[model samples]
Target: MLQSRLFMNLKGIGISFVPRYFFQINLSKIFNEILKYNTKELEEIQVRVRYYNKINQFFTPTEKEKIGKFPFKKTSYAFDAYEISKYFKDKFLWNKDFNDVKWTFKDPTICKSRPLENNKNNILLKLDKNRHFCFLKDDLIFENKKDIAVFRGAVYQTHRKEFFHSYFNKTFCNIGDTSKEASQYRKNFLSKKEQMGYKFIISLEGNDVASNLKWAMSSNSLVLAPKMTCETWFMEGALKPNYHFALIDNENLAQVIDHFRTYPKEAQEIIHNAHKYIKQFLDKKKEFHIGILVLAKYFYYSKQLDLNELGYEREILELIK
Candidate 1:
């Protein structure tokens, strides 16, 4: 206990140390049992499981060596992957060193990728999980909040800058650039609770997928977002425009807002659908199952783990079917 506390304090000061046994959970037996039970709940978990880990190759040792190993403690982003890898009793080549890169990996590697770049090899995991996976509680109903839409975030990306330049002055929207570099466009930062006061919240992609998307969808307010160029464990690609969020670009921001404001029932439907989409992520037990399954599939395909070692390879085949 003393050693653990000391290590934590050292981590707080930017000195990082990861004890080898920290990620070993001995939960594979329990996980296998969960997989053995074929039910509606497990079916839902498998959908997300398939979405995260798409590797379907049998890589030789030589090919796996060429992919190169990424340092685990290089960043907090890599930490999630490192911890998960050890959870399954092995490690593999992975990259959590960068974000929003538009290239796909040729050899099997466990990493995140843009939606368009997502192929069988670029295995996705919930890296940087805290920043990307938050959900907010909202009590305000759509009919009761201010009708104006709100957008407050750093304005560095080309698309973000374009949206700010075009719609920041619009009457129906309250938008601001929060980056120091975008001082001229910057406005006071609005907390998540503060942003929920308005009826619509803009979710724009930054670096990769929009980090705000999960919470924005969880809120009572409707989300205003363009077509997603990237995706994560949230599976942004599956979201239907006009159903989950009102699709908006600079040209149609006002028009879409006007239509939704005038027809609140329609806006309420979008909110309902958004809430439905958010429900899948709310179950912590199923989420753990899905994460384990994703890693299981990843390791299995890469030839790291044997068929019997997963304890339910047949069950995985059936669940995936």
Candidate 2:
């Protein structure tokens, strides 16, 4: 009992000494310890953030992520304890009684069934993640775009590969890698500066969901992607199709391009709205603040927490307010 109090006090003292990024990186580890060991009297349990790098790859027992390791970096997580707990129940926790505990929950290329299928138990908190960094430029204009659309990196699945290849590396389609039979497509990698300059950024479902959309929206360019049935922490349910991105219907790429090109003013409006939305809510500080609420909600549902036990008590209250 005395040792637990000491641990909590040590955590309290140390939290103030570190930068938020330090906490963001280590919160998962810290919280995992609490989740595993601290069930006695719940007080300010550290809510954590992480994601899987393995994606679809199976890990051996040793290679598998340790309990509580949510493996993303660069950006922090707004921990969705409710959704995360559901994951735990399905993949790890086996107690049928946990069904009464209740919970809920992204990505393409790495495919999975439609996201939010069990949203009845899922609780969404806020959006947060890390991606390519580029300086925001006020001078960037639609005309600065070098191509109609630009996509880099590899695509999995035979059909998806063929779709990019059929474009034949010209005009509307300039894929980066040549190995895929878009042999004519440019082989040179597009730098971040060049990607930001383009008028339309292409986001496709890879693995499970596209990670590019968040950062793409951060840039001045307009995002073009299909209506994503898969989801992430902040996308899908949170984002309206036309509001957050220009729709790219299946096999209707040409028509979509013509519409956006002919009516650029409309495209610009969507771009403006997207930029404003991502920038306003997704900044770093708020990212951690949102993470705390996710943890709060999980505890609210599964384990009652005394107000004094919370680490970010003020932030959690602000959610209900």
Candidate 3:
């Protein structure tokens, strides 16, 4: 009778019914049977259970140092500038002013010849001794020299090959703008790169988080997942598209790619598997429903109980039903 009541309650909740006898069996007895002769089975079961639990855990604050050492130096410098601006305001302001002055002065006098007596020997010497030094103007006065040094220091501090590549090489695609012109442009750009034998990866951005992730799965390419620091609306926008590459934010691209490259081989294989799964399941209604169901399970599990928190669970359940 108790088993029947439980099954009836589950059915009323729209869950499919299972045989009542399955629930009637003592769970403790089953567990003991599984562990009877296998001492290692308990440890293996614990590891898997813990792993699944961890996967459902809500986002916890983690120190960068705790995440493991990164393989590549950070590729983005924008955050470095932001960090410096925050803690060293005065120094940052001074550097900014110096950069403005140096660029304002040096750009106009790049090709002008000087008199033999006033040849740029001193400037050449400074350049030779310190590659960072450059003359802002011919006079090389204290103000000019100070400006040049400050600007040069900032430039040198920001210079990193990975940083430049992340900023310029990664492309951002917008699904809303996938007109004929945009399609042709992307086709041509990709063709040119292919012709040159340059490898590339694609990412998609959408208006819904799950949708954005779904699009990433569709691409079969490595993704640079968005950070929580980005605007929520923009993140949502990135997730709404069904068939687009993951759209990497300019600032986060370098960090994400670096993270992926440094990931353990097992992790990399899992990511590759996810990509393949996405590709194989794309446009399949049954798979889409399954994805939603899996997402709901994680969402509810993260909240520590079976109750729905996001309303997405109810929405998806309705759709699936």
The model with the greatest TM-score is: 1
Clashes of 2: 25
Q: What's the CA error at residue 134 for candidate 3, in Å?
A: 57
Q: Judged by lDDT against the true structure, how good is candidate 3?
A: 0.26
Model 1: residues >4 Å from true position, as ranges? Answer: 1-27, 36-38, 61-74, 90-98, 309-311
Candidate models: Cα lDDT each? 0.72, 0.48, 0.26
Candidate 3 stretches with Cα past 4 Å from truth are: 1-22, 26-29, 32-41, 48-171, 174-219, 228-321
In model 2, the runs with Cα more than 4 Å from the true position are 1-114, 120-128, 132-139, 178-186, 308-321
lDDT per residue as tens, model 2, 1-321: 357445544544454344434444444444444344334312322222212111222212222222233322311221222223322212221111111111232111111112534432233333222221222553577756755777776655454566676654557755565245454444777765677777887877655456567677777778888766555544444577777888875477777777888888888889888877666444554444444444434343333333335463453333322
Q: Candidate 2 — what's its lDDT?
A: 0.48
Residues 148-219, model 3: lDDT tens digits: 000000111122222333453233321112224422112222221121121113333222122233333323
How well does candidate 3 score on lDDT at residue 138? Answer: 19
TM-score of 2: 0.58
Clash pairs of candidate 1? Answer: none
If scored against the real structure, what TM-score would every candidate get? Answer: 0.86, 0.58, 0.23
* Model 2 poorest ten-residue lDDT run: 93-102
Instruction: Point out the higher-scoring one by lDDT: 2 or 3.
Output: 2
Error of 3 at 128 (Å): 65
Name the 10 consecutive residues with the lowest summed lDDT in model 3: 146-155
